[model samples]
Target: MSAPRLRVAPSPTGDPHVGTAYMSLFNLGFVRRHGGAFVLRIEDTDRARFRADSEQQIYDTLRWLGLTWDEGPDVGGPYAPYRQSERLATYRPFVDRLLADGHAYHCWCSPERLAQMRERQRADKQPTGYDRLCLGKSEAERRALGGFADTPVVRMLIPDDVPLTFTDVIRGEVSAPRPDDQVILKADGFPTYHLAVVVDDHLMQITHVVRGEEWISSTPKHLLLYRWLGLPAPAFAHMPLLRNADKSKISKRKNPAARLTWFVEQGYLPEALLNFLGLLGYSQPDGSEIFDFAQFSADFEWSRVNTVGPVFDLDKLDWLNGHYIRELDLAEFAGRLTAFAGDPAHADVIAAAAPLVQERVATLREGLDMIGFLLVDEASFAVDEAAAAKHLGEAGQEVIAAAVLALQADGEWAHEAIEAALRGALVDGLGLKPRQAFGPVR
Candidate 1:
């Protein structure tokens, strides 16, 4: 048999979340390792929040990480028109079929009614989804409620008391309370994500449903849909959530690295970023830690990845980045560093400082700070606390002034010589111990 078909479907919205990259890397690695086709599906059905720029970002970010898809919007595959929005015509037939089979019914419940229903359920300490209010509506009543009205949505009637079960690849043997009924199609006539995801997964022949652990609760719902549609449920592997260092949900609002753009701006190598993300929930089965893309793929046995939320330690990631950076040849490093540097005023200093900071830094911003002295026009440079104490005090002021004058007299304008001259003045001329003199400068 051909390798199992796998995919990463991401929603196009505002900023590209690190979560998207994390999930993409996992799927890409898994599919590639098994010699399966990896597909990219764009789920942009939520037209209100849809952004045109998001598509390009998705393509750019994934390609930047060297995660190429066998099929996508930009590339051809068996699943042509690989976007959910373009497949609305396909969805309508399934909705109609569900209604005709009596597996689903017309839901004419209004939002006001839903709110009231939720309140009643809350008072009774019961669950608060739809109450299937329109399930019992007469044919005449259903006809009356029809004709471009917002109330006539389509809902699947879920059977009660049949304990639905599916073996999860991560959290095994998952189940949930089968709902009385579910809205397969909203009043606006758009399919809900639950309906769309299941329908598409079946249609796409996706073998593995690799996703985050939060979706573990929803697995039963998907399982119900599969059975109702008379289709086999795909194997699932719900990987752990990537968390903040504080163990909270990883959020883009709170963390810069949570957004991929920040990492791109900071000049993080895409491969390094991918490797760091992989380390979040997985490690070598034999206990090896250092992993590149190929190594990660070689060791990606789904059973080895954790089910608990993995802490996104940027410090740990920085260490990984250092490893990736060291592995890169200087020419390759220089090319990448140039891209993120863009049009900075002091590109020369940055170029010079790149190698020096290469061994010690995690980000290009850190390297910029190392060459800061070259870029800083000291004529206009104001005194920060250290600069004030080190150069502005009575003794410090005289020494700095003398040093500046002496340095100005025979200056080859260079950072190293300038630093050496300043040190000589402080230690030799000022009669200050090196530690005492450099302490304030530092």
Candidate 2:
């Protein structure tokens, strides 16, 4: 078989989501192991929502996590202009052909009429979609009417009551035939994901389509598109959804989406985050926690990938990060810290946190956390103001001042000295135990 070509196409809008990383890692792994090529494509067809630097950010975020693709919009390939916006001219002909062949039709009904029909249908327990207002019109008739007046959208003809079956690498024998004939091209002259993805994947030689379970229900529409276009369909592999601790799919507000920036800011090693994502739905035979891309690529098996969703457990990630951190030598850790410390805004934070973070910090990856306190530039910390108020009562304040002063007297500034002085302040000044003094500060 030819090397399995796979593409990871993400819509650029906001922060780089972990879903993008998860799918990209899988694609990169599959292609690398099989000597196939990995392609990066940006689906920025939504002009209004398209961000200026978002495509660049996708590249930056993925590369930060050590995930790289062979061909991309930035890095040109045989199939140049990987951005879908640049490919609209390519999709226009296909849309016209589908319309002429009766495989698709122009929908002229306004949204209000369409919504009223859908509401009535929903009120009567029926599927609500386009009522095919202009499906019967011939090409000449549509042209005579000033081309449907609204720039015309192309929708596939989804026949009723026919089952569509496609094999999933993880879940075999899956079928969802006769899905609602979804729109292939919008009136804005941009191809919908359904059309753009199908056409690009075929043109780019994508052999496998590995994505989250969320797209499983929509596979029929894609499969139907392949059949209608008479093109070979890529093998499908729906990696299970990632869940939070409560068994719900991971979300940004509820849980950190394991974004690349989040991992970088948290001081997590790229290798560690890569390993964590690698093991999420796929793991080694002996349950090894840390694996490099080479080891993972050597062992990758699509068949063993889990169908049951996995949880994005922060505690587990912390443990994994700490493990990678400990594996680093003191010099390497300090180098990483220095890189972040070089940031002028974060410099003071690391300076203040230097004594506190010495051996206690699990990852230099957390340089942002060390400097997070400085963001409040008030005479004191604000967000963590409650931190001071919660523990630093009037008497506690006296002990802290005394301790800071006690250490100030000695020119040798060290954590051991500061800690010893603080301990003395707790016992001699506040008459509190060492734990009691530090407990409130924490």
Candidate 3:
């Protein structure tokens, strides 16, 4: 069998979503397992909500997470013009073919008329969908009848026998409700997602469609388009959606973690973040919670995917991140800490303190926080008065004095030597507990 082709298409509407990485992880994992191509298509057709910088953010965040694609807007592939907005001309031919074949028709109903139609349908307790008012009507006839727009939008004419069930690679047989005559092309000359995705996936030779389960309802519409256009449908695998602690669908509007950039900004290791996402709807064969991407790709299987939506557990992520941080060698951890601190000048200070804090922090941000005082100048440093008052009584003063004297007598500059000297003076010599001796100094 030939290698499969898969793509992760994300709309450049806002912050790159964590869903984008989640989908990409599975898509790329399958591709890696079968030696196929993983493509990144930017679905930027939603012009009203599209941000000028969002496409770049998608690239930046995905790359930050180590989810690199073989073909994308930045990296040209066999399928050039990876963005939907750039391929406007390519969709017109398919739309025209659908129209010519009696599979789709143009609707002149304006937004006001469609809204009124939906309002009437809701008032009468009917299934809300286009009423097919413009079907079989000429442009002039529709204009004469009443509400009509100058520009016409294309819609699919759903056949009575439209299949409502399809096989999902992950969920076995899945069924969706009968679809309405969905708009294939808007008056703005942009194709809707239903039309654009079908055309692009077919043309790009994508063999697998991996996305969130929320799209299950829309699968029938896409399958209809594929059948109507005489295009071979790809294997579909709808991954479970990520849910919040309350089991609500995770969204950028309500949850900051839904945004992919949040993980990067929080100083999470990309490997750890990637692994965390992998564990969301999948489990390793060895039943281990912690594993790298290479191991994940090697063991990728659609059958292993859990259909139930996984709750986004941040505490688990923190534990995994801490494990990864501790696994890093001191030199690499120090470098990462300096970079994440966003201050190149603090490299030496962070390096000097890396060993002391490497095992102490779960994230680079926390590591930096632990040594933040050392980064500031002498004048800028201020001890917490409450903390000092609590720990610096007479006994604390004695411990400090003994530590100073012992260090001054034979203090070695090395870590072990300094620790041994301080412990010997404060813990062994002064008969004070280790925490008692170190609490005030720290």
TM-score per candidate, chains pooled: 0.87, 0.86, 0.89
Best by lDDT: 3
Residue 79, candidate 3: Cα error in Å is 1.3
- The ten-residue window of minimal lDDT in model 3 covers 406-415
Give a tens-digit lDDT track for model 3, residues 1-442: 5899999999999999999999999999999999999999999899999999999999999998888999999999999899999999999999999999999999999899999999999999999999999999999989997878999999999999988999999999999988999999999999999999999999999999999998999999999889888889999999999999999999999999999989888889999999999999899999999888899999889999999999999999999999999999889999999999998998998899999888888888888888998998998888889988988988789888988887887555887898899998888998888889899888
Rank by TM-score (best first)? 3, 1, 2
For model 2, the stretches where C-alpha displacement exceeds 4 angstroms are 138-149, 253-259, 342-358, 362-385, 397-431, 439-442
Cα displacement (Å) at residue 243, model 1: 1.1
Candidate 2, residues 1-442, lDDT tens digits: the string is 7899898998887677888999998888878888989999999988877888777878888998889988999889999889999888998877787777778877765556666778899999987666665778866565564424556677888877445777898899886635666888887888899999989999887889988898887898888778777899999989999988889888766665555577766667788888888888788877887888888888788877988999887778777777876777655665567575556555545555555554566666464465565545677655456766777888667666766666667655776777777777666677887766775554
Better of 2 and 3 by lDDT: 3
Among all windows of 10 consecutive residues in model 1, the one with the lowest summed lDDT is: 142-151
Q: Write the number of the candidate with greater TM-score, choosing between 2 and 3.
A: 3
Candidate 3: misplaced stretches above 4 Å?
379-442
Candidate 3, number of clashes:
0
1-442: candidate 1 lDDT, tens digit per residue: 4688888888887778888888888898888788888889998877788899998998888888888888888897776788888888888988888788888888766666677788999999987787665787865675565332445778777776545677887778876555557677877668877889998888889999888877766777778778777988889988888888789998877888788888888767777788788888788766666667888887577777788889999888787777887777776665556556565565666666677777887876666565556666879766577757665678666665756665776867787887777777777878887766664554
RMSD of 1: 3.6
